[model samples]
Each structure stands twice: as C-alpha cells, then as structure tokens.
Target: MTVLPNNLVFRSITGPEELELFNRLPYVQNDELADDLARGRRRPSWMWMALDGDRLLARLSWWCRPQDDAPFLLDLIDVDDSAHDVDRCAVAEQLLRTANAALFPDGVPVAQGTPPPEFLRFVPADWRADESTRRMVEDRVRAVERSGAVPLVERLRYEWFAGYPVPRPSDRLRFRGIESTEDILGLMARALDGTLDAHDRLDLQERSAEEVAAANFADEFANYDTPRTWWRVATLPDGEPVGFVIPARNAYHPIIAYIAVLPEHRGHGYIDDLLAEGTRVLAEEGVPNIRAATDVGNVPMAKAFERAGYDTISAVVNLTWEK
Candidate 1:
C-alpha cells in the first residue's frame, strides 16, 4: 500500500489469480511470462506494478534461480511509453523505490541484463539513433541511477550456432578436463594478474585479486545445472598450464562460462586456441547455440570470439547496486 501521484496504487500482483493482469503489461510477452512461472524463476509476489486504478503505468520484477527463496537480479523495469517523459521517469523511480523497500529490505545487490541484438529485431533499424527511443532508455537508466545503482560493466554477447564454422583446434596447446578445484583456483589466481574482465577488475578495488577470483569462481560454479566434466584446461606440450575454458549449460543455454589465459602466457595468441577448443566441445554436444560474453573493453577476448566464428548477438549493460 504505497502512496503515489496520479492516484496510482503500487503493489504486487495479488496472487496467481492475477497473473493475467501482471502479464498484460506492454513490455512482457505472455508466453515468456508463462514459461518463467512454470519454471519457478518468477512468482506473483516478485512482480510489482504501479497502476492508475486498473490501468498499469509502470512495473518492476526480479528473477532468481528456481531453488532460491530470494531473487538474484532485477531484470525487468518498464514505464508506459505513452506517458510524458518526466512523468514516466517519476513513476518508474517511485515504483522502483517502493519495490526495493518491499522486496529487498536487507539491501542486497541488484543486477540487470540487457537484451542482445537478435532480440531487438522488432525495434526500428535506427533505434539507437532515434531520439524518442534514446530518451526513454536514458530516462529509465537515470531513474535506476537515482536509486543508487551504477553501470557496472558493458559486455558483448556472442553466439555460435550449430552450423557455424569453429576454428580447428591448434595443437600448440593441449586441452584436458580440470583436475581439482584447488588446481583450478591456482590457475584462476594467475589469470587474475592481468585480467581484462570488467567485473573482475572492478572487484579488485575492494578485495584482493585472489579473493575476487575465488568468489567469482564460486558464484559461477553454483549456477551450472550441468556437468562440470565439460570444463577444460589448456596447457603446453610439456604439461604446464597456459589457460582454461569452462563450457557448461546455464539456466538457458550452453555457455563459455569462463575462459582465461595465464598472465605469463598471454601475448602468445593462445586464447584463440582455447576458445576454439571450448566451442568445439559445445558444438560436438549438438546444442543449437553456444553463448558467451566478454567485456567490450577486452579487445583481445572479443577478437578471439570473432575469430572463432561467433556472431555478436547483443550488448548487455549490467547495472548493480552494492551494499
């Protein structure tokens, strides 16, 4: 029961019975909503909307793993496009503030995912240059910023379809499954020394590089619902490790979860071979597509992905509120 301007009422969907009302928002597709509900990644109480009486004006929703009681991210927030720019920003800001207070009283970090290029086909060809679309996007981003969130990183999402050509593996490096968690951690420590991953770099500001790398490894490992046998380490002919790649299935698709070259071995162009091996592993699995992401600023990694024949599918802007 939060108060608002324009005689709007702010609240979560009443229950499963009000799902239609929740899904009726212009931004969400009914089929996608239904799929998420069936998978337990979304719940009625996780969707909060600002309504002008019975008319929906704004909405915010959080997503989480099926087994988790708390949400891991705030992925969706939308305001009515028909509203004035100032009003739209105000409504969205208010909705987010109220939703944050109710859904995350303990002040957990908030994370969001942006759709990739493939998903933006419905948008106009020049949407990025279009004034209205640009303003709307900026307004929403500003509203989120007003709520104490900051853009954490910009990542380029890449996809390798089944028929795409995966580069032939270079015999210069040998690929093998990870031996043990300790061994992998030791490699991760070395990988962090000259890491270009934005999230990893940002984390180094607050924690020791090793601690940040370890925490990242743990967080990623917890998300894999698939076998860890897909993980591979690349080494020289003499068996000294050069780098590693983790090819695993996430909640949605098979992904190159983590790939890194040791700081000492970096400039030798071994990353291309490592990436090819990871893609070859997933391609052999016959998955429709293998998805991967790298920080936009990480030109070497981005180049490796392109050379491996992965298409740039989308760009993701991750905004985070840390406490």
Candidate 2:
C-alpha cells in the first residue's frame, strides 16, 4: 500500500488539542464553526487536516450532514503560514485527492456555494448578490477541474452592515411580538412575491406559489429556539401590518430571519424598528454576537440592519453543485 508523504501525516481527529489547533488558524478559523463540529451538529468524517510530526501544516473540511458518505459541502482549509518551503497547492491538492479517493471514488466531486439555508429569505427582490466563496466555490472548482469536472453555477456573496444602517422607522409604526405561524406566513407569502430567495425562486418556478410558501415555512422559519413570539411585527396603530423582523436562533446563530412589508408600506421606515427589536432579542439571549446578512442591493432592508446596530460580520459567498 502506497502511503501519503511520510513527513506529513493526514487524517481526521476528535481530540480537543487537535480541534483547538484547527480553530486557531487564520482566514477560515471560526470559533462558532468549530463549536458546531465539536457539538456533533456537524460530523468529523467531513473534516480533515495535514500534520507534519506534531506541527500542523494543512487542513481541509467538507460541510455536510452525518448520514452522507460524500460530503458535498466543503468547509475550512488552511496551510501553516510559515511553510513557505512547501508547496501549498500541492498539499491542498493532496488533501482534496485524499478525500475524493474514498468518498467520491466512482465519480468526480464538483462544488458550488449555497449560503446556510436560514439566510435566503432575508435578502430583497432586486439585489444582485455575489458570493465568490473561497474554499467551497473556488477551491472546490480548482480541485475537481484538476480531475476533469466543472462547476456549473455562480456562487455569489453580498453584505451590508453598520456602515449602511437604515434610518429610524417612521412614528406611524408600532412593534409587536408574533405568536402564530399563520400570522407570520401571511406576511411572508406577500414578501415572497418580491423576495430574493433563490430557493423560493426555483421552487415557485415548479410548484404552486402556495405550495412554495408552505415549504418555505417548514424549511426555514418554523424551526427556531427563540419562538415566533420573539419576532417583532411592525404595524400601524389601527392594525395594518407593515413589516416584521425575526430575531431568533436557527440551527446556528441568532438571525434576522425575515423582514418585509407590503408594497404600500414601503419607504415609511418600519424596518428600523423591526431590525432593532430583532437584534435586541438576540443580544439578550447572551450570545456574544449575532449574525445577519442581506442582499447587496436591497437598499431599504440593508439600511435597516445598519440602523439597528448590527455590524458586518463577514461575507458568505454561496455556490451550488450540479447533477
């Protein structure tokens, strides 16, 4: 049996020390991300690293579910900054080939970017997003292309933060917590007619708009640690619904789940209140920080996030694979 380079040991680990080492690297190291893996919310077969003796050198990961053998998702990948003497690309390739050797033995592995599912609903209808995600979209393409497969779609990322906060909403708005899915979905269905969600866009293309709305509810909004009661719906004192904000924890962070208003309600600034209430709810939950992202061009919604005190954490570039 031919082994990998003797000097460098490549494998997966469940040890705290190794996990700590992986979390300390630059560029792709995220404590929350590492936490997800360590918590068994994500699996280790999809995560791997390259070590030289006791010193760490290169790393690669696939972000996928535990039930699957081939990790269609790729996560963090890094090389020791000081390893200038070693070919980084070679090590990266080795890591890719190593994973592909087993998980995708019968065919090539092609990767594209898909933002974590929870975020899709928040972007606006006209925003042209771009992800250009580094490893999953970029590295995956290079890795598979080397094996003769190709990526088929554009993996794009977009962002807005404190630098572009929306102005405070008009005084005509009052905020209230949501208690029922029926109420939330009503606002969402109307919002979807003008939303930027790619999945909904694809779904509505094939399924009835009503069915798309129902599936969207089950897939995204229905599951949350913070109840829909924490959601803030903006409305007129007379009871006309304007917009709403979801400050709830999905499978991961406290997210701005959905923020939308009727067309007639646009331009009056109900979003700021909605955004503020959402962030405040998450901050109260005791998480050190919250994460939210919006479309690059959803001027109004993007502005609301800024006004509400959330900062731009990072840009997540998303791409998807082809069948």
Candidate 3:
C-alpha cells in the first residue's frame, strides 16, 4: 500500500469480501461487483481504493472479458462527494496514476497497444445543466486527464423498453441471418469507410479498416455468448448487400451491438431499417430492455434511435492515455 501525506493510504481490495467497503461511493456498477468478481471479469487486484483511515475516499476499478486475462476497460472511478474538505480530484488522480503503473508496468499489452484500457464513465443525459452531476463527472474527467488520459469520445446512450414501438421492417430491403463470420467481417470493414464514429475514426488513424474490423470482431462481437443467429444482414431486393445489424445480449443487457449502412448505400435512410430490425429481434426475445450507444456527434444515428422510440437515458465519455 502507498501512504500519502494526508494520512491517506492507497491499495487494492483484499478480496471479494471487502466489496462492501469498496462500494461506499455508490455507482451503477455496485450491484454487479460481486458477480463480476465471481465470473472473473474483475479481480481484486484490479479494484483499488484510496482510504482515509477507515473511510473510503476514492475508488478505481478495471473490467475485462471473462475469458481474457488483461484489463479491457477502466470503467469505474469515483470519489466520495460528502467529504467536504478533501481534494477528491487529486485523490482520484493519485489513485489512477498508482493503479495504472502497477497494471501496465511494461507500457503496453500484446493484444492492444499502449494504454490498452480506456476509461469510461456514465453520466446523466443533462449532466451539464445539473451542477452537482456536472461536478461529479467533470472532476473524474479532470482527474483522468491529470493522470495523462485524454478525452476520446462522448457518446449518447439510449434504451428501449419492451413496450416501445419498433418500426416495421423496410420493404426496400430484406434481412437475413448472417451466413458466416467472414460475411460480417467484410461488411464491418466496408462500413468503416466514411464512418463518423469517434472510436472507429480514431483507430483508422493508425490501422487499416480490415485490421480494425478484425480487432473489433475478436475483442467484442465474437465474445458475446448470445445467439449468433440474431445477427442480420440487410440486402436489397435484388440481392445487393446494404448493411447489417447484430442484436445480442451482452454480459449486461440485450443490445443493438452494431448497425451500419454500407458506404455505397448511404443517404437512403437504410440505417433506420437496420436499427429497427435489430430492435425488433431483441424485443421479440422478450428482453425487458435494449440498449445502444452512438457518438454524440453522429446526428444521423442519434436521430434514428429517437425515431425508433428509444430514449436517451445517459451519456458515456471515454478517455484514454495519449497513445
């Protein structure tokens, strides 16, 4: 454990039994901590805390694919809001710096390059208009910034309840179950062209579209245990491929994992058809909720979700150490 000047000590939780102590500053992931730990998506060593005596002042945790041994996302970070005199942001920054060094001593992971794990924080949809909420979020952002991470993207998160009206499938295009993984890979690579997604665009800077598509497939799309038959490719009546959608239940919720209109098929409102098909598939499965996200700047996607009866429930900001 590292001791700080203000009698604060930083260290990882001793074990799953210490989760209650770590949950002092509540967040959305509180309920999943136990399951995540048991399922191997989280490890005690990846969960760190900065404590003032017996009080939990700040906490940071990373999550990863259950089958993978390395951290995939730095998803949870929080500081006690009620601790009036504490420099909470500073505490968070220090905790992040210490944990990151211990987590990535070699400065890189073999699968993902430098700063493999990116920080993701969920905030209220109108966080900026709410002073307390804004402060709570911005403080964490500033702390991560202080630890050498830069804001990469801010995405609008949406949710669709079972009762929400899903659009009728398009008459212009027909949807079919994915024929094979190679087919989806080909379309994913093609969709990267003219992509407005912040994450995809960032990756395209250093990697080819095919390489990025393959990486996404291996790291995410292929990892979900949900039925692969739920994936669909939308093709024109003439049998020309337009786009595709993957509706799958991830570790948490049933989600429209991906939807895209091919570069050549853009400007025809085909995205709506793709999204609707994805939502319809999940709703038919009797899922209570379906969730999806798109970059805040991707107006077309945001509008499509709104038109399809999905509500903007929150926003997620992703930050990463400068590569």
Candidate 4:
C-alpha cells in the first residue's frame, strides 16, 4: 500500500469482501463487478483505491479475458467528483501511477507482447456538448495524461434491440459460411487497406496487414467460443467476394464482432448489406440486444449502423501510453 501526501491511503482492495467499499463511486461496470470477479475476468490486486481514512477518493481497475492471466484493458477509473476539498485529479493520477508501477515494473509485460493495457471510459454520446459531463470526462483524461498516457481514440458505441427493424438480407450479395481460416484472413488483410478504424490503423503501422490479420484472428476472433458457422462471407451473385461479417456473442454482449468491406467494393453501399447480414444473424438468435462500436472518425460505418436502426447509445474513450 502506498500513502500519498495529506494522509491519503492508496492501495488495492484486499479481496472480494471489500467490494462494497471499492464500489463507493458508482460507474456502469459496477453491476458486473461481482460476476467478473467470480469468473476471473478481474482480480482484487488489479483494483486499487485512494482514500482519506474511510472515505473513498479515487479507484482504478483493469479487465481481461477469462482465460488470460494478465489484465488486457484498464476499463474502470473514477475520482470522487463530489469531493471538493481534495485535488481529485491528482489523487487519480497517483493511483494510476502507483498501480501501473507495481503491475508493470519491466515497462511492458513480455507475456502480453504489447504496450501496457489501454484505459477505457464510457460516457454519453454527447459527452463534449454537456458542460458537466465534459468536465468530468476531461478530468479523468487529464489525470491519465499526467500518468504518462495519451488519448488514443474515441469510438461510437451502438446497440440494436429486439423490437428494432433488422435490414433485409441483401439480394445483390449472397452470404455464405466461412470456408477456411486462410481464406477469411486473406479477406481481412485486404479490408485493412485505407481503413478508418483506429485500432486497425495502429496495428497496420507496426505490422504487415497480413500479420495484423493473422494476429487478430488468433487473439480475438478465434478465441470466441461461439459457433463459427455464424460467421459469413459476402459475395456477388456471380460468386465474387465483396465483404464479410462475423456475428458472434462476446463475453459481455451479442455483437457484430467485425464487419468489413473490401477496398474495391467500399463505395457501392455494400457495407450496409454486410452490416445487415451480421445484424440479421444475431437478431435471428432472439437476443434482447446487439452491441457494436466503431471509431468515431469512421463516419461511414457509424452512418451504416444508424441506418440499420442501431441507436448511438454512448461513446468510448481509449487512452494508451503511446499514440
């Protein structure tokens, strides 16, 4: 446990028994905290808090895949917004700095083979337009920046409910189950050309498109325990490849995990068809809702989701040690 100036106690929760104490500052992930801990997606050591004696001042935590041993995303961080007596931002910054030093003394974990986990915060879609929300969000961002991180990207999150209209499957393109890993990886690599997605762009900068495709396939898509038959490849009626979509349930939600249009076919409204096919697959499963996210700058994809009856429910801010 690290103690800050002014007698602020900084340390991780000792165990699940301290969850009630850890949850003093409310956030969206609170509902899943218990389940996440039980399922091994979170661990007590990964959750830290700053306190003034018995009062919670700031908290931080990281999350990861159930099968993984290390944290993958720093999804939760909060400062007591109502506490006016303390520099809440400084408290948060100190909490992040201390936790990260203990968690990653070697700069980056060799097991993860990337930079430290990025920070994620969820906020209203109009986070910037509202003064109070903007202030709160920027405070956390500034605190994170002071801990040696920078804003990476903002993404627009979307959700489609059961009552919403799912676009009809395309007549111009036929959808078929994925034939083989190699085939789909080839398609994914080709789709990376001139990509607008920030995550994809980041990978492309460090690795070949094919390398990124194979890595993503192994790290993300292949890790899904969901049925692979739900994955689909879109092709012209003449059997020429157009695009593909992977409609699957993730740990948290039924999602259109990925949908991409090949660079050559991008401008012809084919993305709408691809998204609809993915949505149709998940909708047929009778899910209550299907959630997805795209980089905020990817306006075309955002419009496609909006066109397909998915509501722009919220936005996600991602911060990383590197740009």
Q: List ranges where model 3 is wrong by over 4 Å.
A: 1-5, 108-113
Of 1 and 4, the candidate ranking higher by lDDT: 4
Candidate 1 vs 4: which has more TM-score: 4
User: Where does model 4 exceed 4 Å of error?
Assistant: 1-5, 111-113
Global lDDT scores for all candidate models? 0.76, 0.58, 0.90, 0.90
Better of 2 and 3 by lDDT: 3
Over the stretch 192-290, how does candidate 2's per-residue lDDT look in tens digits?
776665555656677776677677777567655566677888888997888787766666555666667766677666666666666666556565556
lDDT of 4: 0.90
Model 4 over residues 1-323: C-alpha lDDT tens digits? 22245788889999899999999999988989988999899999999999899999999999998657788899999998888777778889999888988888876744546778888999999999989899999989999989778888999999999988878765899989988999899999999999998888988998999999998898899899889998999999899999999999988999999999999998899999999989888888899999999999999999999899999999999998873
The C-alpha TM-scores of every prediction are 0.87, 0.67, 0.95, 0.96
- Consecutive 10-residue window with the lowest summed lDDT within model 4: 1-10
Candidate 3 C-alpha lDDT tens digits along 92-190: 999988887777776664445656688999988889998999999999999998877888999999999988786777799998888888999999999
Residue pairs clashing in model 4 are none
Q: Which pairs of residues collide in candidate 3?
A: none
Q: Model 1: number of clashes?
A: 2
Residue-pair clashes per candidate: 2, 16, 0, 0
